[model samples]
Target: MSENRKSKVGSSAAVGNVGKKARNFKPTMKKLISYLSDYKLSLVIVLIFAVVSTIFSIVGPKILGHATTKLFKGVMAKISGTGNIDFNYIGKIILLLVVLYVISALFGYIQGWIMSGISMKVTYKFRKDISEKINRMPLGYFDRTNHGEVLSRVTNDVDTLSQTLNQSLGQIITSVTMVIGVLIMMISISWQMTLVALCVIPVSMGLITVIVKYSQKYFKQQQDYLGHLNGHVEEMYGGHIVMKAFNGEEKSVHKFNKMNGQLFGSAWKSQFLSGIMMPMINFVGNLGYVGICILGGWLAVKRTIEVGDIQAFIQYVRSFTQPISQIANISNILQQTAASAERIFEFLEEEEEIPEVSNPVKLQNVNGSVEFKNVHFGYNTDKIIINDFSASIKPGQRIAIVGPTGAGKTTIIKLLMRFYDINDGSILIDGHDIRDFTRGDLRSIFGMVLQDTWLYNGSIKENIRYGRLDATDEEVVQAAKAAHVDGFVRTLPAGYNMILNEEASNVSQGQKQLLTIARAILANPKILILDEATSSVDTRTELKIQKAMDNLMKDRTSFIIAHRLSTIRDADLILVMDHGDIVEQGNHEELLKKNGIYANLYNSQFEVA
Candidate 1:
């Protein structure tokens, strides 16, 4: 039991450290406010109405207290002097209360409408900015980050901020103003009783401070757990097929349960602490109220204070305590909003890839003569995947690159496309360095089909049209036939209009690869790249795909990366690669005679097949 207690204490200390760091870790209020810049008018309107509404709230309670005092005095005088109630005085008090109620309600509506508009405008801009930023980010950024983490930043964090703005801001403002107005009223009624009421202020604040410290830590943990939950679920769902095939269901479930249990505990702790806040404040408030009541009654009965003054003092005490309690509640929300704002701002501040040159040269109708001069490249600064590599291809030549896995075969194509700039060399397209051309110009010159073909959820016609947005229906059909995918499309219920399911899961792997080839064909690029394109298909499908590829390669520069040697047997040039260097180069017969790495690979998989 002692050890358990000590462990709990240590865990609490760690949580305390985290919370303190989060609270003091620079609020992004200024950065978050920038999103509201576009809606300056609405924000100003909200502030104006909130101030007016708060003033009305303070005035209404004072007017009620004043009317109650007047009624009591009038009743006492009438009963003693005339033995009848003063109807005129009664009517006046009723009229005053009604007037105060109407004014308060009117300002309340104005405040609500204005704040609602501000919240909506801010949310809209927040979503739009994040979306645009995601689009502008380099492709490699997404490769390194999880999908669900990014989603949590946009969807969950922004959603939390939206609620804080809509529901909490106006109440906080009004509550604060009411507290100030009530304090002044209390002093006017009876300074002694007012001081008594003030005694609880510091004590209540101290208690609230302790609770807030506890809650802040749990809230931050809660947000992180939610993000983890999102990421875990995404991973489990995306790889369900692999998991089932490996018989890893139990393992996956155990992992999920552990994460889910943490999420549950964190959520409960956060909410439970927040829920206790209101009641705790109320309890302290009741204690202060009782103290004030006893003291004020003693002074009133002794005639040191008026009966009316005691009544007003009690009213003021209630007003002060209520707003302080409300402020405590708002403080909790602000902590959460601050936590979410940190995440959203971090995303906004992420480094984007360098922007395109102001005036880029556009390559028109590229002839597809490619040259790599002493190219050295790496995805990261410290690691070089391709070192001092060089290659040249004349227009319309079919060059095949064969290598063991991780020999930088795919890196060649990436460099040509400028996905990551070369670390130590340059690439030229038709005598102009590729960097001189705009991204669109460089990409428009080549069409690609990878081993894992991905199709969007859309009709076959639409997917093909994505390759060349301006293509006519006839052009799409021609390209499909050229790629030998038209026959399969015609067999579907909707032909070209048939909708592909998610990631083209509804189609066979071979058919999906062919459709992707059709997409590449529709673009009519000057150069073509086939990166293990036929490896995932059946023998018959490979034959048909090879026939289509041969037709597609005609009069175009083609660079083929293949593991199977038979696919590249007839190439004009075959380069055997090892450790990012070209060790040998020749046609199939020549490489076979040399009997190098290429010959061995060919003998193992391709020549024998």
Candidate 2:
């Protein structure tokens, strides 16, 4: 028992081992820097400006030292009657410093413009690539992932990395240049003072290394918790009606509070450490400055160095410390930016489910005969949903599939649409395997109406036109009339142009279903699949919908799936499925005569209704 407890504890540590993961995780800085390859000219300009800016900045302090030293010498010369004091050098040095300041400011503006453009361009590229990849992905990929996670990756994560790349990169470059330039200038003035300044580096480095390591872990956790919170909020809001109907608000709030509390703690820790960076580095910088001032003052009093040189060294110490503090402060932003980059790259690294064929087959003008030959499939490998399933339908045959829920009813339609490929066997269209046809050519032949319809935020006309992008207004009207939706649509103030937001939420469920029927009809597909299309509507509406379905299904190969068995009485073939196998199949009267599974389901629904 003791050994088992120790093993369990060890397992727990492995599961929660964030520190080990972080240590092993490598940031994609090299890949990120490759984005700058296209911006070589801009980068060159930035580099030039940074160098000029640092040079000018370094000169300003040295000029002040020279001027102060000259002024003191002039006073001494006058008191001692040393004949003359030269103000010419002082005047030239003052002018040079002023000119340098002007050039530095100009370069600063140029650098800002170029880096901002580069960052925005990189962000645009990242977003565009993600969008394109999403378009090419299989539908099942989205079914398993949260919508909010995708949104956060594109918006929040990309935005965070963009700011870091643009602003932080520039600051790091400028700080390093300024620090180098100041130290070089300091050594030229007096190596003794340069040595004193260098002494602070060890202490500053030790403190920063420790703080950064701790802050990095917290920052990454902060991002992860925030992602969880976003996912929770999106899920809760998306299912609000169901939650409220079941009075699950308290439970939802408790879940949200738990996620929110974790986010709050991680965020506080990350930000608190980042916030302390400037002040802590500033204190260290001040200590170094005091040392420089004290040591330089002593050297000057002993006449080992000119008073002017001491003054210049003091200014150099100030300049050096300022950039060091900035570098230390910017380290936090760098870490955060690196964390965001890792996330964005991670998303980009996900392998797309549907890869384009090296030599794709483009099929044209398909005839509607479909065959499923011993198909086996599953969303995952462990549990096969459709096993050794075989079905064949002739052109324009209307088949109705009635099954218990989770008996691979909807899975059939999904597989037919290539939303997923069969694990074994082949689905054939026009006697040709579906995998032999290009995805576009294969999907173009079928139109599907689902149980839960989706309408985009657009005018009514636009939603119908989505079925056929180039469909005419007259064509749309004809389809709408056939679906029996034209009557309600014409009554709206805007007629066909009436705007619908939140997917026609203001309309009744039956009307929404009708609109979807109109869309499917507009497509004029050779094959149709209705997955419980009329199940949500009232009896009267269902009858009306049945008439529309009759019109739509005419002379087309139609696959209808529904648990409401009464609606499928006129189907050419009725397949009653149980536990992923067809238990009975025949015409409606034949199935009724058989007194089998279909008859039992029919009687059960009739009793319930």
Please provide TM-scores, in order, for all candidate models, with all chains considered together: 0.92, 0.93
> After aligning candidate 1 to the native by TM-score, how far in Å is the CA of 300 from where it should be?
3.0
lDDT, candidate 1, at 23: 48
Best by TM-score: 2
Q: RMSD, each candidate, Å? A: 6.2, 5.3
- Reference-based lDDT, each prediction: 0.80, 0.80
| Candidate 2: segments with Cα more than 4 A from true spot | 1-27, 78-91
CA displacement after TM-score superposition, residue 405 of candidate 1 (Å)? 1.2
Native-referenced Cα lDDT, model 1: 0.80
Clashing pairs in 1: none
| Residues 456-536, model 2: lDDT tens digits | 889999999999999999999999998889999999899899888764776778888888989999999999999888876
